[model samples]
Target chain A: EDQVTQSPEALRLQEGESSSLNCSYTVSGLRGLFWYRQDPGKGPEFLFTLYSAGEEKEKERLKATLTKKESFLHITAPKPEDSATYLCAVQAYGDVTSYDKVIFGPGTSLSVIP
Target chain B: DAMVIQNPRYQVTQFGKPVTLSCSQTLNHNVMYWYQQKSSQAPKLLFHYYDKDFNNEADTPDNFQSRRPNTSFCFLDIRSPGLGDAAMYLCATSRGRTSHNEQFFGPGTRLTVL
Candidate 1:
Protein backbone atom coordinates (compact mmCIF):
# COMPACT_ATOMS: atom_id res chain seq x y z
CA GLU A 1 0.00 0.00 0.00
CA ASP A 2 1.17 3.55 -0.76
CA GLN A 3 1.24 5.81 2.25
CA VAL A 4 2.56 9.27 3.10
CA THR A 5 3.32 10.53 6.58
CA GLN A 6 4.32 13.95 7.87
CA SER A 7 5.86 14.55 11.26
CA PRO A 8 5.20 17.23 13.87
CA GLU A 9 1.51 17.82 13.38
CA ALA A 10 1.91 21.42 14.49
CA LEU A 11 4.79 23.83 15.04
CA ARG A 12 5.01 27.25 16.63
CA LEU A 13 7.86 29.60 15.81
CA GLN A 14 8.79 33.17 16.60
CA GLU A 15 9.23 35.58 13.75
CA GLY A 16 12.50 35.09 11.86
CA GLU A 17 12.93 31.61 13.31
CA SER A 18 13.88 28.88 10.90
CA SER A 19 12.59 25.30 10.82
CA SER A 20 12.09 22.27 8.62
CA LEU A 21 9.08 20.00 8.00
CA ASN A 22 9.36 16.37 6.95
CA CYS A 23 7.27 14.24 4.59
CA SER A 24 7.99 10.52 4.40
CA TYR A 25 6.34 8.09 2.04
CA THR A 26 6.26 4.44 1.07
CA VAL A 27 5.08 3.74 -2.45
CA SER A 28 5.43 1.28 -5.27
CA GLY A 29 7.30 3.61 -7.64
CA LEU A 30 7.96 7.27 -7.12
CA ARG A 31 6.92 9.46 -10.01
CA GLY A 32 6.91 12.86 -8.37
CA LEU A 33 6.72 14.58 -5.00
CA PHE A 34 4.88 17.85 -4.49
CA TRP A 35 4.80 20.54 -1.80
CA TYR A 36 1.97 23.01 -1.23
CA ARG A 37 1.11 25.78 1.21
CA GLN A 38 -2.46 26.31 2.32
CA ASP A 39 -3.75 29.29 4.26
CA PRO A 40 -6.82 29.34 6.45
CA GLY A 41 -10.13 29.29 4.54
CA LYS A 42 -8.31 28.74 1.25
CA GLY A 43 -7.08 25.91 -0.91
CA PRO A 44 -3.48 24.94 -1.28
CA GLU A 45 -1.00 26.82 -3.45
CA PHE A 46 1.56 24.92 -5.44
CA LEU A 47 5.09 25.25 -4.17
CA PHE A 48 7.58 22.75 -5.55
CA THR A 49 7.75 19.46 -7.37
CA LEU A 50 10.62 17.03 -6.91
CA TYR A 51 10.82 14.27 -9.48
CA SER A 52 13.87 12.27 -8.44
CA ALA A 53 16.18 11.68 -5.52
CA GLY A 54 18.56 14.56 -4.88
CA GLU A 55 16.21 16.99 -6.64
CA GLU A 56 15.66 20.33 -4.93
CA LYS A 57 13.74 23.55 -5.54
CA GLU A 58 13.67 26.88 -3.79
CA LYS A 59 11.47 29.95 -3.69
CA GLU A 60 11.95 32.93 -1.39
CA ARG A 61 12.40 31.45 2.10
CA LEU A 62 11.17 27.97 1.22
CA LYS A 63 13.37 25.16 -0.07
CA ALA A 64 12.27 21.61 -0.80
CA THR A 65 14.52 18.60 -1.17
CA LEU A 66 13.63 15.00 -1.89
CA THR A 67 15.18 11.57 -1.35
CA LYS A 68 14.27 8.02 -2.20
CA LYS A 69 11.90 7.58 0.71
CA GLU A 70 11.21 11.10 1.98
CA SER A 71 11.18 14.84 1.35
CA PHE A 72 11.97 17.91 3.42
CA LEU A 73 10.58 21.46 3.31
CA HIS A 74 12.93 23.96 4.90
CA ILE A 75 11.72 27.41 5.87
CA THR A 76 13.97 30.31 6.75
CA ALA A 77 13.05 33.55 8.51
CA PRO A 78 9.34 32.94 8.33
CA LYS A 79 6.78 35.72 8.73
CA PRO A 80 3.14 35.68 9.74
CA GLU A 81 2.17 35.63 6.06
CA ASP A 82 4.32 32.55 5.63
CA SER A 83 2.49 30.74 8.37
CA ALA A 84 0.24 28.10 6.80
CA THR A 85 -0.36 24.37 6.60
CA TYR A 86 2.24 22.65 4.49
CA LEU A 87 1.07 19.65 2.50
CA CYS A 88 2.99 16.97 0.62
CA ALA A 89 1.83 14.49 -1.98
CA VAL A 90 3.39 11.70 -3.98
CA GLN A 91 2.42 10.25 -7.34
CA ALA A 92 3.54 6.75 -8.22
CA TYR A 93 4.96 5.82 -11.58
CA GLY A 94 3.34 2.50 -12.44
CA ASP A 95 -0.09 1.00 -11.72
CA VAL A 96 -2.38 2.38 -14.38
CA THR A 97 -5.28 1.58 -12.08
CA SER A 98 -4.03 4.24 -9.72
CA TYR A 99 -3.10 6.80 -12.30
CA ASP A 100 -4.09 10.36 -11.48
CA LYS A 101 -4.02 9.39 -7.83
CA VAL A 102 -1.81 11.61 -5.74
CA ILE A 103 -1.70 10.45 -2.15
CA PHE A 104 -1.41 13.30 0.33
CA GLY A 105 -0.04 13.25 3.85
CA PRO A 106 -1.53 15.00 6.81
CA GLY A 107 -0.26 18.57 6.65
CA THR A 108 2.06 20.35 9.08
CA SER A 109 0.51 23.42 10.62
CA LEU A 110 2.99 26.23 11.14
CA SER A 111 2.24 29.32 13.20
CA VAL A 112 4.67 32.20 13.15
CA ILE A 113 4.23 34.51 16.09
CA PRO A 114 4.80 38.07 14.99
CA ASP B 1 -3.46 34.93 -15.88
CA ALA B 2 -4.15 31.28 -16.38
CA MET B 3 -5.53 29.98 -13.13
CA VAL B 4 -8.25 27.88 -11.53
CA ILE B 5 -11.34 29.72 -10.29
CA GLN B 6 -13.97 28.46 -7.84
CA ASN B 7 -17.20 30.28 -7.20
CA PRO B 8 -18.85 31.12 -3.89
CA ARG B 9 -15.86 30.91 -1.65
CA TYR B 10 -18.21 30.12 1.22
CA GLN B 11 -21.39 28.07 0.95
CA VAL B 12 -24.12 27.46 3.52
CA THR B 13 -26.58 24.61 3.10
CA GLN B 14 -29.08 22.99 5.41
CA PHE B 15 -28.79 19.36 6.39
CA GLY B 16 -30.18 16.94 3.77
CA LYS B 17 -30.21 19.79 1.25
CA PRO B 18 -28.48 19.69 -2.09
CA VAL B 19 -25.64 21.98 -3.09
CA THR B 20 -23.32 22.49 -5.99
CA LEU B 21 -19.82 23.94 -6.20
CA SER B 22 -18.44 25.19 -9.47
CA CYS B 23 -14.90 25.48 -10.76
CA SER B 24 -13.41 26.80 -13.96
CA GLN B 25 -9.91 27.08 -15.32
CA THR B 26 -8.32 29.04 -18.13
CA LEU B 27 -5.20 26.89 -18.24
CA ASN B 28 -6.79 24.42 -20.66
CA HIS B 29 -5.82 21.49 -18.53
CA ASN B 30 -6.93 18.00 -19.35
CA VAL B 31 -7.62 16.87 -15.79
CA MET B 32 -9.74 18.27 -12.99
CA TYR B 33 -10.08 16.98 -9.42
CA TRP B 34 -12.12 17.48 -6.28
CA TYR B 35 -10.82 16.96 -2.76
CA GLN B 36 -12.42 17.22 0.66
CA GLN B 37 -10.42 18.51 3.59
CA LYS B 38 -11.13 18.71 7.28
CA SER B 39 -9.20 20.53 9.95
CA SER B 40 -5.65 19.24 10.38
CA GLN B 41 -6.21 16.29 8.07
CA ALA B 42 -4.98 15.37 4.63
CA PRO B 43 -7.07 16.41 1.66
CA LYS B 44 -9.06 13.36 0.59
CA LEU B 45 -9.62 12.76 -3.10
CA LEU B 46 -13.34 12.56 -3.78
CA PHE B 47 -13.20 12.13 -7.53
CA HIS B 48 -11.59 13.47 -10.71
CA TYR B 49 -12.31 13.87 -14.40
CA TYR B 50 -9.71 13.00 -16.97
CA ASP B 51 -10.81 14.71 -20.14
CA LYS B 52 -14.46 13.64 -20.32
CA ASP B 53 -14.03 10.45 -18.31
CA PHE B 54 -15.20 10.48 -14.70
CA ASN B 55 -13.42 8.49 -12.05
CA ASN B 56 -14.43 8.07 -8.45
CA GLU B 57 -12.39 6.88 -5.54
CA ALA B 58 -13.34 3.60 -3.94
CA ASP B 59 -14.32 5.22 -0.66
CA THR B 60 -16.28 8.10 -2.15
CA PRO B 61 -19.98 8.10 -1.31
CA ASP B 62 -22.70 8.01 -3.95
CA ASN B 63 -24.08 11.28 -2.63
CA PHE B 64 -21.21 13.05 -4.32
CA GLN B 65 -21.36 13.51 -8.08
CA SER B 66 -19.47 15.62 -10.60
CA ARG B 67 -19.96 17.14 -14.03
CA ARG B 68 -17.58 18.48 -16.65
CA PRO B 69 -19.52 20.34 -19.26
CA ASN B 70 -16.40 21.40 -21.11
CA THR B 71 -12.65 21.38 -20.81
CA SER B 72 -12.60 24.41 -18.57
CA PHE B 73 -15.61 23.96 -16.31
CA CYS B 74 -16.36 21.39 -13.61
CA PHE B 75 -19.02 21.07 -10.97
CA LEU B 76 -19.37 19.05 -7.77
CA ASP B 77 -22.90 18.17 -6.73
CA ILE B 78 -23.87 16.83 -3.34
CA ARG B 79 -27.33 15.30 -3.25
CA SER B 80 -27.68 15.52 0.51
CA PRO B 81 -25.07 17.13 2.68
CA GLY B 82 -24.58 16.05 6.26
CA LEU B 83 -22.86 17.87 9.04
CA GLY B 84 -19.82 15.69 8.49
CA ASP B 85 -19.68 16.95 4.92
CA ALA B 86 -19.09 20.48 6.08
CA ALA B 87 -15.54 21.09 5.08
CA MET B 88 -13.39 22.69 2.42
CA TYR B 89 -13.90 21.41 -1.09
CA LEU B 90 -10.91 22.07 -3.31
CA CYS B 91 -10.63 22.02 -7.07
CA ALA B 92 -7.39 21.30 -8.85
CA THR B 93 -6.27 21.04 -12.45
CA SER B 94 -3.31 19.45 -14.18
CA ARG B 95 -1.95 19.74 -17.67
CA GLY B 96 -1.80 16.15 -18.84
CA ARG B 97 -0.95 12.55 -17.96
CA THR B 98 2.78 13.15 -17.87
CA SER B 99 4.38 12.15 -14.60
CA HIS B 100 5.95 15.55 -13.95
CA ASN B 101 2.91 17.76 -14.26
CA GLU B 102 2.06 19.69 -11.11
CA GLN B 103 -1.54 20.54 -10.24
CA PHE B 104 -2.83 24.07 -9.62
CA PHE B 105 -5.62 24.51 -7.09
CA GLY B 106 -8.36 27.06 -6.64
CA PRO B 107 -9.15 29.04 -3.51
CA GLY B 108 -11.71 26.35 -2.46
CA THR B 109 -15.27 26.46 -1.20
CA ARG B 110 -15.98 26.23 2.50
CA LEU B 111 -19.29 24.39 2.95
CA THR B 112 -21.18 24.95 6.16
CA VAL B 113 -23.90 22.37 6.74
CA LEU B 114 -26.49 23.62 9.18
Candidate 2:
Protein backbone atom coordinates (compact mmCIF):
# COMPACT_ATOMS: atom_id res chain seq x y z
CA GLU A 1 0.00 0.00 0.00
CA ASP A 2 1.15 3.55 -0.70
CA GLN A 3 1.57 5.61 2.42
CA VAL A 4 3.01 8.97 3.38
CA THR A 5 4.10 9.87 6.86
CA GLN A 6 5.31 13.16 8.31
CA SER A 7 7.28 13.32 11.53
CA PRO A 8 7.25 15.92 14.31
CA GLU A 9 3.51 16.47 14.26
CA ALA A 10 3.94 19.83 15.97
CA LEU A 11 6.94 22.12 16.20
CA ARG A 12 7.39 25.40 18.00
CA LEU A 13 10.22 27.56 16.77
CA GLN A 14 11.27 31.04 17.74
CA GLU A 15 11.39 33.69 15.08
CA GLY A 16 14.47 33.43 12.85
CA GLU A 17 14.99 29.81 13.82
CA SER A 18 15.87 27.25 11.24
CA SER A 19 14.23 23.84 11.18
CA SER A 20 13.41 20.93 8.96
CA LEU A 21 10.22 18.87 8.52
CA ASN A 22 10.37 15.34 7.26
CA CYS A 23 8.06 13.45 4.90
CA SER A 24 8.65 9.76 4.41
CA TYR A 25 6.81 7.67 1.88
CA THR A 26 6.45 4.04 0.81
CA VAL A 27 4.95 3.58 -2.61
CA SER A 28 5.00 1.34 -5.64
CA GLY A 29 6.55 3.89 -7.98
CA LEU A 30 7.16 7.52 -7.09
CA ARG A 31 6.03 9.92 -9.74
CA GLY A 32 6.25 13.18 -7.80
CA LEU A 33 6.38 14.62 -4.34
CA PHE A 34 4.59 17.84 -3.42
CA TRP A 35 4.75 20.33 -0.56
CA TYR A 36 2.00 22.72 0.45
CA ARG A 37 1.35 25.29 3.15
CA GLN A 38 -2.11 25.63 4.67
CA ASP A 39 -3.27 28.36 6.99
CA PRO A 40 -6.11 28.08 9.47
CA GLY A 41 -9.51 27.57 7.89
CA LYS A 42 -8.10 27.97 4.40
CA GLY A 43 -7.06 25.77 1.52
CA PRO A 44 -3.51 24.65 1.04
CA GLU A 45 -1.21 26.70 -1.13
CA PHE A 46 1.14 24.95 -3.51
CA LEU A 47 4.79 25.18 -2.57
CA PHE A 48 7.18 22.83 -4.33
CA THR A 49 7.20 19.66 -6.40
CA LEU A 50 10.12 17.23 -6.40
CA TYR A 51 10.18 14.60 -9.13
CA SER A 52 13.35 12.62 -8.57
CA ALA A 53 15.89 11.71 -5.96
CA GLY A 54 18.63 14.32 -5.35
CA GLU A 55 16.32 17.03 -6.73
CA GLU A 56 15.86 20.24 -4.74
CA LYS A 57 13.76 23.37 -5.01
CA GLU A 58 13.80 26.64 -3.11
CA LYS A 59 11.68 29.70 -2.63
CA GLU A 60 12.79 32.57 -0.47
CA ARG A 61 13.37 31.10 2.98
CA LEU A 62 12.06 27.64 2.16
CA LYS A 63 13.91 24.79 0.52
CA ALA A 64 12.73 21.28 -0.34
CA THR A 65 14.93 18.29 -1.08
CA LEU A 66 13.92 14.83 -2.22
CA THR A 67 15.36 11.36 -1.80
CA LYS A 68 14.41 7.84 -2.82
CA LYS A 69 12.27 7.18 0.23
CA GLU A 70 11.69 10.60 1.76
CA SER A 71 11.70 14.39 1.38
CA PHE A 72 12.68 17.27 3.62
CA LEU A 73 11.33 20.79 3.86
CA HIS A 74 13.89 23.10 5.34
CA ILE A 75 12.96 26.47 6.67
CA THR A 76 15.62 29.15 7.02
CA ALA A 77 15.09 32.04 9.41
CA PRO A 78 11.40 31.41 9.46
CA LYS A 79 9.12 34.33 10.23
CA PRO A 80 5.78 34.35 12.04
CA GLU A 81 4.12 34.51 8.65
CA ASP A 82 5.65 31.16 7.85
CA SER A 83 3.69 29.56 10.67
CA ALA A 84 1.30 27.11 9.04
CA THR A 85 0.68 23.42 8.54
CA TYR A 86 3.05 22.00 5.99
CA LEU A 87 1.63 19.15 3.95
CA CYS A 88 3.47 16.48 2.00
CA ALA A 89 1.91 14.48 -0.80
CA VAL A 90 3.12 11.85 -3.19
CA GLN A 91 1.85 10.76 -6.59
CA ALA A 92 2.47 7.20 -7.65
CA TYR A 93 2.46 5.55 -11.03
CA GLY A 94 -0.52 3.22 -11.10
CA ASP A 95 -1.56 0.49 -13.57
CA VAL A 96 0.18 2.12 -16.53
CA THR A 97 -2.63 4.62 -16.82
CA SER A 98 -2.66 8.35 -17.34
CA TYR A 99 -4.30 8.93 -13.96
CA ASP A 100 -2.13 8.70 -10.88
CA LYS A 101 -3.56 9.17 -7.40
CA VAL A 102 -2.02 11.51 -4.84
CA ILE A 103 -1.76 10.52 -1.22
CA PHE A 104 -1.16 13.20 1.43
CA GLY A 105 0.47 13.06 4.80
CA PRO A 106 -1.09 14.24 8.05
CA GLY A 107 0.97 17.45 7.88
CA THR A 108 3.31 19.18 10.30
CA SER A 109 1.98 22.08 12.33
CA LEU A 110 4.66 24.73 12.80
CA SER A 111 4.40 27.69 15.10
CA VAL A 112 6.83 30.58 14.91
CA ILE A 113 6.81 32.53 18.14
CA PRO A 114 7.94 36.11 17.85
CA ASP B 1 -5.30 35.82 -12.36
CA ALA B 2 -6.18 32.21 -13.07
CA MET B 3 -7.37 30.67 -9.82
CA VAL B 4 -9.85 28.27 -8.26
CA ILE B 5 -12.83 29.69 -6.36
CA GLN B 6 -15.24 28.03 -3.90
CA ASN B 7 -18.56 29.34 -2.66
CA PRO B 8 -19.90 29.58 0.90
CA ARG B 9 -16.79 29.78 2.98
CA TYR B 10 -18.85 28.42 5.82
CA GLN B 11 -21.96 26.25 5.66
CA VAL B 12 -24.37 25.12 8.38
CA THR B 13 -26.82 22.32 7.76
CA GLN B 14 -29.03 20.06 9.78
CA PHE B 15 -28.41 16.35 10.05
CA GLY B 16 -29.92 14.41 7.12
CA LYS B 17 -30.33 17.61 5.21
CA PRO B 18 -28.90 18.01 1.75
CA VAL B 19 -26.27 20.62 0.98
CA THR B 20 -24.29 21.58 -2.05
CA LEU B 21 -20.92 23.26 -2.35
CA SER B 22 -19.85 24.92 -5.54
CA CYS B 23 -16.48 25.53 -7.10
CA SER B 24 -15.29 27.33 -10.21
CA GLN B 25 -11.97 27.85 -11.84
CA THR B 26 -10.58 30.45 -14.19
CA LEU B 27 -7.51 28.40 -15.06
CA ASN B 28 -9.33 26.36 -17.72
CA HIS B 29 -7.81 23.22 -16.35
CA ASN B 30 -8.68 19.76 -17.60
CA VAL B 31 -9.18 18.16 -14.22
CA MET B 32 -11.05 19.09 -11.04
CA TYR B 33 -10.99 17.38 -7.66
CA TRP B 34 -13.00 17.38 -4.44
CA TYR B 35 -11.52 16.45 -1.10
CA GLN B 36 -12.84 16.24 2.43
CA GLN B 37 -10.54 17.30 5.23
CA LYS B 38 -11.23 16.75 8.89
CA SER B 39 -9.49 18.69 11.61
CA SER B 40 -5.83 17.77 12.05
CA GLN B 41 -6.05 15.19 9.26
CA ALA B 42 -4.99 14.94 5.67
CA PRO B 43 -7.45 15.77 2.93
CA LYS B 44 -9.18 12.65 1.60
CA LEU B 45 -10.02 12.52 -2.06
CA LEU B 46 -13.72 11.93 -2.70
CA PHE B 47 -13.75 12.22 -6.44
CA HIS B 48 -12.39 14.00 -9.50
CA TYR B 49 -13.47 14.99 -12.97
CA TYR B 50 -11.28 14.69 -15.99
CA ASP B 51 -13.01 16.87 -18.52
CA LYS B 52 -16.50 15.33 -18.52
CA ASP B 53 -15.60 11.95 -17.05
CA PHE B 54 -16.18 11.46 -13.34
CA ASN B 55 -13.91 9.32 -11.25
CA ASN B 56 -14.90 8.30 -7.76
CA GLU B 57 -12.60 7.03 -5.06
CA ALA B 58 -13.10 3.54 -3.80
CA ASP B 59 -13.83 4.54 -0.24
CA THR B 60 -16.11 7.44 -1.02
CA PRO B 61 -19.67 7.15 0.28
CA ASP B 62 -22.62 6.87 -2.05
CA ASN B 63 -24.30 9.82 -0.34
CA PHE B 64 -21.63 12.09 -1.71
CA GLN B 65 -22.20 12.96 -5.36
CA SER B 66 -20.63 15.42 -7.73
CA ARG B 67 -21.51 17.14 -10.96
CA ARG B 68 -19.49 19.04 -13.48
CA PRO B 69 -21.75 21.20 -15.58
CA ASN B 70 -19.00 22.74 -17.64
CA THR B 71 -15.29 23.29 -17.80
CA SER B 72 -15.26 25.98 -15.13
CA PHE B 73 -17.88 24.74 -12.67
CA CYS B 74 -18.18 21.76 -10.34
CA PHE B 75 -20.54 20.97 -7.50
CA LEU B 76 -20.41 18.58 -4.55
CA ASP B 77 -23.80 17.40 -3.30
CA ILE B 78 -24.27 15.69 0.01
CA ARG B 79 -27.54 13.89 0.04
CA SER B 80 -27.68 13.22 3.73
CA PRO B 81 -25.47 15.02 6.18
CA GLY B 82 -24.33 13.55 9.47
CA LEU B 83 -22.28 14.81 12.37
CA GLY B 84 -19.36 12.78 11.11
CA ASP B 85 -19.66 14.49 7.77
CA ALA B 86 -18.72 17.89 9.11
CA ALA B 87 -15.44 18.90 7.56
CA MET B 88 -13.71 21.25 5.19
CA TYR B 89 -14.46 20.55 1.55
CA LEU B 90 -11.67 21.63 -0.73
CA CYS B 91 -11.79 22.13 -4.48
CA ALA B 92 -8.74 21.89 -6.68
CA THR B 93 -7.88 22.03 -10.37
CA SER B 94 -4.98 20.91 -12.48
CA ARG B 95 -4.04 21.21 -16.13
CA GLY B 96 -3.65 17.53 -17.05
CA ARG B 97 -2.93 14.00 -15.85
CA THR B 98 0.83 14.34 -15.52
CA SER B 99 2.16 14.12 -11.98
CA HIS B 100 4.28 17.20 -12.58
CA ASN B 101 1.26 19.47 -12.96
CA GLU B 102 0.60 21.57 -9.90
CA GLN B 103 -2.92 21.73 -8.50
CA PHE B 104 -4.49 25.05 -7.58
CA PHE B 105 -6.76 24.97 -4.56
CA GLY B 106 -9.67 27.14 -3.57
CA PRO B 107 -10.28 28.66 -0.14
CA GLY B 108 -12.49 25.68 0.80
CA THR B 109 -15.93 25.42 2.42
CA ARG B 110 -16.25 24.59 6.08
CA LEU B 111 -19.26 22.36 6.54
CA THR B 112 -20.90 22.22 9.94
CA VAL B 113 -23.59 19.69 10.70
CA LEU B 114 -25.98 20.83 13.38
Highest-DockQ candidate:
2
Docking quality level of the chain pair in candidate 2: high
* Model 1: how far residue B39 lies from native, Å: 1.4
Off by over 4 Å in 2: none
What tens digits encode model 1's per-residue C-alpha lDDT throughout B13-89?
99999999999999999999999999878899999898998989899999999999999999999999999999999
The Cα error of candidate 2 at residue B50, in Å, is 0.6
Q: What lDDT score is found at residue A37 in candidate 2? A: 98
lDDT of 2 by residue, B17-80 (tens): 9999999999999999999999999999999999999999989999999999999999999999
Q: What is the C-alpha RMSD of each candidate to the true structure, in Å?
A: 1.3, 1.0
Score chain B of candidate 1 by TM-score. Answer: 0.97
Q: How far out, in Å, is residue A98 in model 2?
A: 7.5
Minimum summed lDDT over a 10-residue window in model 2 chain B is located at B95-104
